[model samples]
Target: MQNESSGPDDIASILSNPILNTDSYKASHYLQYPPEASAMFSYIESRGGRYDRTLFFGLQMLIKEYLCRPITPAMIEQAKAFFTAHGEPFNEAGWRYIVEHHGGYLPVRIRAVPEGSVVPTHNVLVTVECDDPQVFWLASYLETMLLRVWYPITVATQSWHLRETIRGYLLKSSDDLAQLPFKLHDFGARGVSSAESAAIGGAAHLVSFMGSDTVLGVVAANHYYNETMAAFSVPAAEHSTITSWGRERETDAFRNMIARFGKPGAIVSVVSDSYDLFAALNAWGTELKQAVLDSGGTLVIRPDSGDPQTIVLQTLRALEASFGSVVNGKGRRVLNNVRVIQGDGVNPDSIEATLATMDQAGFATDNIVFGMGGALLQQINRDTQRFAMKCSAIRLGDEWHDVLKDPVTDAGKRSMKGRLTLLKNHHTGEYRTTTLPVAVEGDWEEALVTVFDSGKLLVDMSLAEIRSRAHAHEG
Candidate 1:
């Protein structure tokens, strides 16, 4: 299929075509529904996996990027031709009807929990239904893209849990929580599968921490979440930068980094394991200690090799032995001008172990930071929280019927029934999932608010507001 506008425009059009965005199996689903079927309802939830609560996010980004655009004839023709060859049935009449009657805007309504709110798993997080009876299949058709929200939601939830764990350590061993935001830094950009994954997953990590080395994540948050600057990074050295100086000139390389970026109040990270981590520490403490102190900046030493839980404490003690330490009001040892960042083998378990070791050693949590890469962005999957979108209710001939899946083999896989609405009691501050007897009405507030309707964005959230909600849940 071709368009009047060629090349990039055509590619963009084809890539952005919502009709073609779904699974090939969905292309044949429009005809499989009952002839009297006029509306279909489906909802997404975490069927209970890694964490108890999930942080709702990424829907606004999906809506603005994919659903808001009106479909075109070229897209319909493209999908038809592709589906013909791919052996899946195409709904040409359905596509043309949507284009002609609804101006190509999908006739669907999306209600979702507000982004950044952390709610218990196995509860409805988002609900989809067709607004136009003529397009009863639209709701499930969009599931292919809508369910991708699980990626960001999982990343955000995991990051929030990491923050809570770190906060607990800090509270136990430190005098202040001022440095909490910069504790866990995102290093997942290069580790993600795609640019979109890096952008979305990186932005999701920003919901918890203010530190990140993923520039694409910062750009994503600014573009999609309306934040001026969602996260920040300091000048940091990589293995290549340190190793480039040659083993003989490693000291010079470290000095050069301090000279270039070690201004007052600035923090610079240097990967010290390029040669011998202990030897490098000795040099920094003896030969380079004065220069480091005179530079009026902090040097964050990164130990990228060895066991994280053990190496982190050793790095802290070595730094203290070189620079010495002072007892803070909290009665924990704070290293003088040096800090440690454990960037290798970092995960939730390792982070907790490292912090526990530090606490037992009487070191302040403020003396070290963490940099997470693949585990933060690429390691999680839909099953990380058992995320699923299933049809819960369908309308046939003016009668609504509950749709459910009760797998006797696995009771945990049993799906919800009927139209569902998430309700929160203000008096008790508790949330419950209940079946809506009919269309939602009256003063009974529903937690699931309409965020998208017929190609229009009903709610646009910012990163700052999202971060606030995510943090507030912990309180």
Candidate 2:
């Protein structure tokens, strides 16, 4: 990458901007100003206010393009008022300060699996460096973006794999593949850490598949794409009560629920493990079916407490016997209109196992939906994933410094250092890593290019565009 110093005019323009000097901007609230601003004013004066231009450029671009921009002036003003009322000075600095004061800049290169690539554990997902001796401090902060960007990708990629596996089985078992459309719903948000993370993670998963998030992931996804997102889902219900050792429910409770939701072909999820599931199915199943049909809705019996494969098979058979008929527009016979959804302890391995059992018992997997919760979000232990990241190099005075971290206990925790070049194997198409000298004795244009320069983003991608890129790579 070519390196250049920020000119006087550029520096002047940056300093003169109102956003840099005043608390009127919400970003300014992150600055360390006010009483400290007076003390730091001298520090600013002493250094002529010239920080790392390259770092500042990157920070500015991120704030402008990624973090905050569509934020209204009213919102900024509101934040300023709130901070002032709380007696907290709105003094803030961008990531540049975190990067520069923390470490000196060294030339670093990063190689990652294109966003949608299905990556396995122990892979060197990303590599970083700085071009100057003093800029190595920047490596620490990169984790904020690196982890944030990559974790959701990893989780979504795994979810997509599971969906693919399930779809394969469904296609094989179903008599008419065209009758059923594959739909994957995201019910993991309630189990996630925070609402924002859930939305982002949910949206990422939805990019590769389909889902209905408890929170507003669809809206956030639209903003990420810079366009409207078109997504919908089957309206669903939760478990209200369970009978002891039976599937029977108080008829009044069921009647009340159907009335409130105005059942319009909606999915009513009931916990069937409270009683003998078969007895519950035999007694209440017929009444529920008639009530659902009368209400212009279809009953989706959810067996949350029994062996999923067994419950699904029994429910399908019972429904077929009671309301047997020829196939409808949605493909399955009228009896299949009342579907089966299984939840609780539904992990990838368990799902696979359940599908095998269903196949053995001659159950139509297409007639059921999977409402996964904690298993999809938190069940996949990170220890099993074996994901690691490292900064392998720094640019020294006319040379490259190699830095490697030897694993202490875990075999997959080691990292390779030095200026490394990523090469693609022509035949196998796998990435090959090679160490290189910091300085190019000859012109090598392919070696490095400016992605983010002087704190400005040269490449901007819409969410839809990125999603399309991900899908294309999968193909």
Note the clash tally of each candidate: 0, 36
Residue-by-residue lDDT tens digits, candidate 2, 1-475: 5333354335544333323333334333324222221100000000011111000001111223333222233333444455567666542332333234433121333333333433233333344444333333334334444334444544565566676667676666666544222345567888877766566666665555555654555665665545465345654545444332223345555555556553665655554445456655664456666665666665666666766666667777786776564553434343555667777667777788877776675565666667677766555433334334454554344544565677689544556655554343434434444455433323222222333333433344455554564444334
Instruction: Give candidate 1's error at residue 214 in angstroms.
Output: 1.2
Candidate 2 worst ten-residue window by lDDT:
39-48
Off by over 4 Å in 2: 1-113, 120-124, 132-134, 148-150, 175-183, 241-249, 252-280, 294-297, 325-335, 408-411, 421-429, 433-454, 458-475
Measured with C-alpha atoms, the lDDT of residue 229 in candidate 1 is 85
Global lDDT scores for all candidate models: 0.90, 0.48
Clashes of 2: 36
Cα error, candidate 1, residue 135 (Å): 0.8
Best by lDDT: 1
Candidate 2 accuracy as lDDT: 0.48
Q: Which stretches of candidate 1 lie over 4 Å from their true place?
A: 1-11, 438-444, 473-475
Q: Mind sharing the TM-score for model 1?
A: 0.96
